[model samples]
Target: MATERMAFDDLPPAVLAGVESHAGEIVKAEMVSQGFNSEIAARVFTANGAFFVKGLRADHKRVWTQRREAEVNPFLRGIAPALRWQTEDAGWVLLGFEALNGHHADYSPGSPDLPKVADVLSRLGEVGCPDIELRHMEQRLERYAAKPSDLAHFAGNSLVHTDLNNENVMVDGPAYLVDWAWASRGAAWLDAAYWVVWLMAAGGHDPQSAERWAGRIPAWQTAAPEAVTAFALATVNVWEEIAGEDPDPWTAGIRDASRRWAEHRKAA
Candidate 1:
């Protein structure tokens, strides 16, 4: 179950004022019940237009994430909603974006959204890594690498949205990626690899089927098979450690799914 969402009316006065300034006189502020990253995730309405505002307390441990999203937004064109305004005031950090009227993409098997998701991945794979300081994909996966040199396969210039969970995708006509706090610079097929583990966890496909779905993305097709296998195994280790620290059905499910993928890779 999701935690309670923060409503526009419930915002602290200073935060509310800042949000209104970036948006307009609030007509309605409907909280989005999905997604867990932001303390506030809502569509702020005004006579002028609706803008999505998501934020957290300035003192929050993840406050730096606000900067990451703001930094990456300009280079994300089409892949993410446009950032309109950002404010830091009254112990809070807030960002306003073009409100999107879309629901999360269904990665479940046979969902028509799969094609669009694949298309977005292929398109994003083509974008050169932005000239910014970001965590390198290889470094991020080092703990899970079977061999130190296996990390080398992950080096590339493509910008990657490291988390491709279903909640991070919104689709109206085209899919829009969101919650970019974990964005990184990595191999072109990196995001596709992330998506495969989630697809398996969602019961959308077996490992073979999931890889086939990912293959629709050009980068995934060309990625070295050994690297793909290493990633699958690395995901198993990553999720296993996460579940051990905070065991929950969601984390456990991903760990299990990743294990299945790793087993399939071994047999292949």
Candidate 2:
């Protein structure tokens, strides 16, 4: 379930004071409209500098996501914004991150951001999975796979940012992946596969074109033909379930794109 967003002024006094203690008095705050997970998502200006702050009550069902983000931050150096500080006070867990000055990545066909994003994914494939609690890809996709044995293809030690929504990618001169909430230990090629669907859905790329882009990452090329087909079929089931649960345009688009990709993979 999505949390109702709150503005800075609505925060408890203790939480505000904690933020102030670390970053100085909050001179102004601009709530970010993107993303659905955080209850408090804003760019806060303080005497020290501007920082992006997001928080959820300590006892919230999804509070574990906060810890996951914090735990994974250290391993995402250069790929994501640095986590400057974290605080748990007034029944809330808050994370302050270095504010980034960039726009959401443009995934449309012919956009220059495509190459930049592919480059970042290539670099990310090199980062070893840190020794921390993380969801494993095989387990996550097990129920959706055609057969239990197919799950084996999704297992690996590479750290992957599974959610490749264009909005989660920030682009300036270089592309940066954000939202570590769904970081997982998965095959190095899986992230590239995930991006292929987003490319078709958001970039208007056909499956052939999208696969061409995925081919840019060496890890992607390492994926076995059967493994890629299994992933595509499993993704169709995953997106259909998501769209069924949340009937929204975005979910529907992705569901349709997943179907298209699955069909393409089957024909090949």
Candidate 3:
């Protein structure tokens, strides 16, 4: 699902003008090569200040995600970099963010960044789900669940950032979660479960150690054993489909880690 990247200067003249209308004249722009969602991702220095900008063509299939991120930004003030401005013009829709100063969180075993990530997830669980348009977790996983009834385990009104890839979290003085496009309403405990999978794949933590780290999150204590087991299995099905479609190293890694976690859950 990665979009083809575009350089800042390659944008249409009108699109560049629109960006400057909100951010003042662009002095310098550096392409950010990490994330996969945005077609155009960069850090721009304007007379006003520095800001992170990401956008996609209006006709792109995944363009809806651009609007989703903007809608969800108001609720993520402390947990994410603030949205400073957004402009849609000349066939492109762009958003400018506050340009957080930090590096992606390190999920490797025994790293100090782990505790900072825990704090961010704990705070995210407390945010009330807004009345805006958002998908529910059960609906998202229904096609992959073991049975229709088992989907209830994922239903809730709490806000959930369903994607917990290490790159989605930034760490410095205070950790921040980025990429709100996949945010959904779901059970509070599900985010902790998502983190467990990433911990194994990105941190080399075994299932037991991953769950131990998940225990640091307050919501994880509320998760029932059967619910977690069901989630582990559903995660395998979800990633299997994703890896099958994409056939990439990253997707394969997640699919393999998900299967290992499911195997451990079944044995327990």
Candidate 4:
């Protein structure tokens, strides 16, 4: 479905109204899927500056997801983009922010930015998370395991930008992480580990660097290796279920990494 075309007109009325409310005049709008979430980017000219109004679909999980993200965004501003505003009356979560000036990170071979990406990931680790009980790898794994075909692998909780692919990251002055719908507490290594597989799947063939990146995660160093591997495998399995037959390269990469980690777990 990656290549399938979706029209903006088909969007829910609530989504359109929410965008219109934020944006006095909608100059342009586009349907973009950043991971599992379907978002609409609406351009508007405001008094301060031109802003991109983002609207997330009101699904079964949107309410709690938005609330959790909104709660934590203040702490994550320097580490990631801020969540501007969210409204429930319109059945849409609205976020307005200054449009990013840089292009998405390309994870192909010979890309000059792998280390930079690693640096960003490392920096992300330093931002402390509150002891809030959000979703974790173990619970997600159980959900996927129960209905394996319906979902993919599950990785239980740590603070994770679960959808950290190239597009989700933009390098303006500094690398900015966007898209928080799937953001949850999971295994600390799972985010970097998942990104490593995503980068490789996008033609980034730096397994050694990927391993190094994974090693840098504090959770991996502190947590039992077996627990970490189980979480990683569960995460991969959840993706595999979501990805189905035509899995993205990133999904495939995660699957491979999960297997290797699983083997290591057995060995340990």
Residues 224-247 of candidate 2: C-alpha lDDT, one tens digit per residue:
999999999999999887888667
Clashing pairs in 3: none
lDDT of 3 by residue, 1-268 (tens): 7788989889999999999999999999999998888999999999999999999999988899999999999999789899999999999999999998889999989989999999999998888899889999999999988788779999998999988998899885889999888989999999999999999999479999999989999999888998999899899999998889667887888899999999999999
lDDT of 3: 0.92
Error of 1 at 95 (Å): 1.0
TM-score of each: 0.95, 0.98, 0.97, 0.71
Q: Rank the candidates by TM-score, best first.
A: 2, 3, 1, 4
- Candidate 4: C-alpha RMSD after superposition: 5.2
Candidate 1 per-residue lDDT over residues 137-205, each given as its tens digit? 899999998889889988888999988899899997999998898889899999999999989998859
Whole-model lDDT values for every prediction: 0.87, 0.92, 0.92, 0.59
RMSD (CA, angstroms), candidate 3: 1.2
Ranking 1 against 3 by lDDT, winner: 3
lDDT of 4 by residue, 194-215 (tens): 6756754565455555556567
The TM-score of candidate 1 is 0.95
Two-way TM-score contest, 3 vs 4, winner: 3
Off by over 4 Å in 2: none
Off by over 4 Å in 1: 1-5
